[model samples]
Target chain A: MAERAYIMPIALRLWHWTNALLMILLIISGASLHFTDPVIPLIRFDIARTIHNVSGIGVSVLYIFFAVWNSATGSWRQYIPELKGLKANLDRQNYYVFVGQLKGDAPHVVPTPEQKFNAMQQLTYIGVMYIAMPVVIVTGLAFFYPELAPAQLFGFDGLLPIAVLHYVAGFGLTMFLLGHLYMGTTGTTVAGGFRMMITGWHDEHDEKPENEQP
Target chain B: MAAIKTVIWAAIGLVLLTTSAIAQIERKPIAPEDLKNIQDSNAKCLECHSEGGFDTLNREGVDKDKLRDHLVDLGVYEGSNHGRVECKACHVKGFEEFPHAADDKKQINWCDECHTRKFLRIEMQFDESVHAKEGIKEKFTCSTCHDPHVFQAAKYMNSPRDVVRQDNDFCLSCHGSDQSFEQVSKEARPDLVENHEWLPNRPLHWNAVRCVECHTPVSKKVMSHEILPAEKAEKRCVACHSADSTLRLRLYKHMVSEERSRVGFVNSMILNEAYVIGATRNVYLDLALGIFAAVVVFIIVLHSILRIIAAWVRSRRNG
Candidate 1:
């Protein structure tokens, strides 16, 4: 039997699932708005615009809760690994993905109570949540109240540059989402990662103990 | 002897100069048949009216300001819709004589005289405009905004950006310049920027759209001339930010045909002029992003397949 650990708290799990739903809504609606067409419509322009605005505002509000909750609980540490530890973890991950995976070896790191994310996961989450999310939110607010944006940015209309920034950040987050889903499969079992997120119980060992050995 | 020599030379120079000047002034007399041709008549009028040599209005001792008012850029006039119309068609009254009658100065053409049928709606709207109010009506006229010599319809212009520049120029020519605004209005000229402090990105909005988009009433016509009071102007940003932006109906009405011709895309035409955030879309960006996402998904699926195959082989070897 495998050892178990409770890593995903109920509050964290709730926030995670809600954020996921909001992100999905925002991405779909954002795509619909970007490619608005009458003939083969993705979503009606009016509806998509409303959904995007609403979801964007919702995500922004939820992000405030995330920041405050993470800070209060000291869970933000999981997302900001020490440089020395991160370098070591990253080197191991690099080798595991490139060399070890081809040799049918298991991942070099696993989620534990002390560190919820591996080095690469921590870097990506920090970027998406702390940096890219803030940028997207600020730019979205500028769009909503365009009169507030600087009249000129680098000799271009302030909204022009802000719009580009918003699109790029959104694109980065979307690509992160694609990679995150794929990486979820590389755990003790193919479904183990997904089960942990849902059940909040990480199976500490592989289904077959032999697979845990090099 | 020296005085005699100087006088002789001066007298000869004066005679020669007078003869040369007279020769320069000489011109072929217009045949009676040529008088019937509008082009010949236009050429005759342009000889004195158009900007050029030392013989036009400058030679007539007209002040610089007055000369500027009368001189028409022949190129612009030729390119205009009224290009083919004979000068005499519009200048029907006192323009025949060289020093034309002063009384006929008031014989300036009124737009309604010729544009009665085609511009009936605009004329109606203009009559109801704030500019047409009792005291201001006498000072305001069609030529105040529309220069007959260079006027071109927004539809005929190359792009929406050009249309915005041209249309805004009409309003700014008066509202934007203190000299021009004071010429028509007795009221104190308000500072345009100061008045629009509440507006976000004032310069961008001013450049992207015409003043009339907010100042004028929304209408089914290509343009509305019934200018509302400042307080009555659209204050809500959603008027233009939403999917059914009023800009589509008012400022961008001319480009509606172009947009419709694009078949599937909505608000693509607006992208050519300005990005209205939610209202505007870029198909190229969407396509590229779509392709990127598709490739990412394909890679994920391929990786998942490989992982499944590896696990199956490992399990079989263990068994």
Candidate 2:
């Protein structure tokens, strides 16, 4: 049966869009600073540095708000990957993405208010939000206030290793974003996922089987 | 009649001498512009020295080892900052005639004569330096570190890298080599590398930055010639790496202006020019990020291609 569900709330949608814009700005400005010579004219080195720092602080604040909001709404559970259905979810998701979709098979998982993300999506988001983002943010702050940080950490000079960690985390985050963008296109229509994210609802008819029509 | 004749002769002699003196005073004075354009008289000395000057023995027949101390490399001197100035300007009180007297040949140049006004502040600071306090000032004159003829302003150096190279080279010329070290310090000299055990990556640090950057105490927009003791040298990495580094106050003050604010996190514009190890952003990190993004894109494209091929084969088999 075709169903209609309000998976994303207005506040969540607003936070998501703002976070996305800030992440994009941070990445661009950080890139400009990293490659200083033959400067990116869109934002000069000084301006880019200012933007990167400001956006970093903005993203940090937004991340805290996201955590608080997720906890308040009891929606944080959606990102926690449960071991009970993990293997089956992974197998079905993999088959659907790699082979079944090619053969016109219906998707195994449907979006609901309780479980908005599939097992793969849940795992990926957990790593990005909890691991990558935190590492980058902490290292960035350490770099900003080097005086307070230890001169050496784990037998290496703190700042260089911290910088490397931040860079590597940024790389991981960038890859996650790429994968996220590609996965968005795998919906019923190219823009269907984007529309669902913008509005709070997803039309179940897009993925429902024709033989099982209500 | 004899007395009157003698008086007439004396009067005539006096008048003739007075007229000659007055005529000498009326002679044309040399124009200041002409004096400026006057050729250096030291060119005569360069005639023999310009060839294999330092390699040849002195007129006093000093040994080859001691010959180097007496002989000047004319080629190097000719290209120096003081090349145009007459040697007699500094080597005054001697060399009025060729083959100067043995005692007069040892005349030392007085730096204070011309530099008193220009270098008064530096001189004052130098008087308070460890070198002066320890009575080592006589051993290490201006020429000990800076060769007046060859020395160029750090600002006019080809690049920042070149400035750093020359500055380190000047310091290492004495500290790094035994021959030069013996000339300055009578105390048993410590091995340059061994003495710097506290600094990690010592050679790399030496090559990348000026010795004065760390050794000299911080002064506003200028390198303090009053070098600090080795124990007092700036050893902390945060001194240069932090937002409020003294590097901004001294070495990189020119980069800071009204455009840059202390509130701006990236007020230290020196990071734009050089990769300051831990402090500045690096190109290698950018390259790695780029490669990671490319690989991700490739994976997505490959998966899409495989999916399209699989779909085509399945449809053909069904038909």
Candidate 3:
């Protein structure tokens, strides 16, 4: 038997794809700008600068809109994991991915409309969306309009710390994206998670594990 | 006897008047032929002036200091931008005599005579400089900072380090040396190193960045000549230490076009020429991040491969 639940909304799907596109553009353009070389130019310097600036602004604006919309619709709850038994739940999820999945065991937790993300996804999403995105956005804007950055920070130029922070946060997001994409394939089917995002419905089979982990 | 004395006095007054009138007249641009003729006439001037020898007729009043000031190194002058300029063009015609006329020293060659239109913007900038202040005007002139005999333009130089050294040398020639300062101002010289003690790595800053970077107001469109006083100099390290440093607008503005053409990392290009503390990139940091990302990708790929293999094995066993 299979059970279906409405997971992603139309608005959320639109925002997700738009944000993904912008992030990809920003990463490519930012890499071009950072490691610019005469012979191995991925993008023209002027063009890369333009793309980075435009995509940065686009993502920043989109994030603000998504934040307000999520708050208003009370959908923000999906990203907030229950603090009670959090460590145990996280441990169980980690066990399923690391050990149980290889032994052909079923997952202990499944997604629903009320709790759309698992414990790990909730924590990772909160960190990336709330912390890393804001840091990178603020730092990116500082680089774009440098005059706004504080003239000094702890005896160093303010931009130096800001540049370092932006690099770290951007790097974290890039790593997270790779992991997130790979994790998407670990659902009921290889393409099940991706199809769920597109169609706004999640389908999970109630099949018992052939070799259950005692 | 009284009539003869009066006549001698009148003739001297008439000669002074004629010399003053000649000094007041501004010379117009001359033809190439005339300029060559005037330059050729400088052979006699160079004979005494080159390599710093004494004036045989006026050796009694001449001291070592005065002789040293008057001496022009022939090689240096020939290499200067003003190498071909006629000596008489600056010093009025009557200087050929054994005892040079008194007014000849005061007969200033206003730089505008030949450099009229080309330097209009620079002339305007000079007008606003601290050196051009009312009381300071009499103490300084173009020659105070720029020794026409040995000056070479910064733009013509290939290396930016050489340009920075040359430009700072112009300021330090007066500010750093007491002997040079005494030639112009009566005020006691301030110690250059002591005044900049508050700055970290003072020598590096002095050599890498130009004195004008701090001493002059920033201007992106053109080089600023409004030299601020020591009290007014930029105190904020962020002014140059920041990624969007004011150095980009002033000192590095000239290199921007070439940097763009090469499409190298902006800070890397700056690092190639000069190492600014916070403005440049860290190779170690970049390498570490690159390795970290590569490891993350490897883990993701490995995990997915193992999971796929497990699923295939389970399906085969169930069937």
All candidates in order of DockQ, best leading = 1, 3, 2
Complex DockQ per candidate: 0.10, 0.08, 0.10
Question: Which residue segments of model 1 deviate by more than 4 Å?
Answer: A85-88, A98-104, A152-156, A205-214, B1-273, B278-295
Cα-based TM-score, every candidate: 0.57, 0.50, 0.54
Model 2: per-residue Cα lDDT over A69-116, one tens digit each: 888988788888778867977887888898787776766677777777
Candidate 3 Cα lDDT to native: 0.72
Give me the TM-scores for chain A across all models, comma-separated.
Answer: 0.90, 0.88, 0.91
Q: Which ten residues in a row have the lowest lDDT in candidate 3 chain B?
A: B17-26
Scored by Cα lDDT, where does model 2 land? 0.66
Who wins the TM-score comparison?
Answer: 1
Clashing pairs in 3: none
| Deviating ranges (above 4 Å) for candidate 2 | A39-42, A152-157, A205-214, B1-108, B111-289, B306-319
Q: Interface RMSD (C-alpha) of each candidate? A: 17.1, 24.0, 20.1
Q: Determine the backbone clash count of candidate 3.
A: 0
Each prediction's fraction of true contacts recovered: 0.16, 0.19, 0.24
Across B156-197, the per-residue lDDT of candidate 3 in tens digits comes to 455566768888989988888889888777778888878888
Residue A129 lDDT in model 1? 90
Count: clashes, candidate 1: 1
Expressed as tens digits, the lDDT of each residue in B1-319 for candidate 2 is 9999999988776345322210111223556664455344675555333446544525554344644455566566644556556777877666555565567747746676788764787777778776777678888777667877677555433334566776778888977788887887776666777877866546556755687888888887467778776777877655665445566665555445522321122432453333353245444555666787888899899987876686688789989
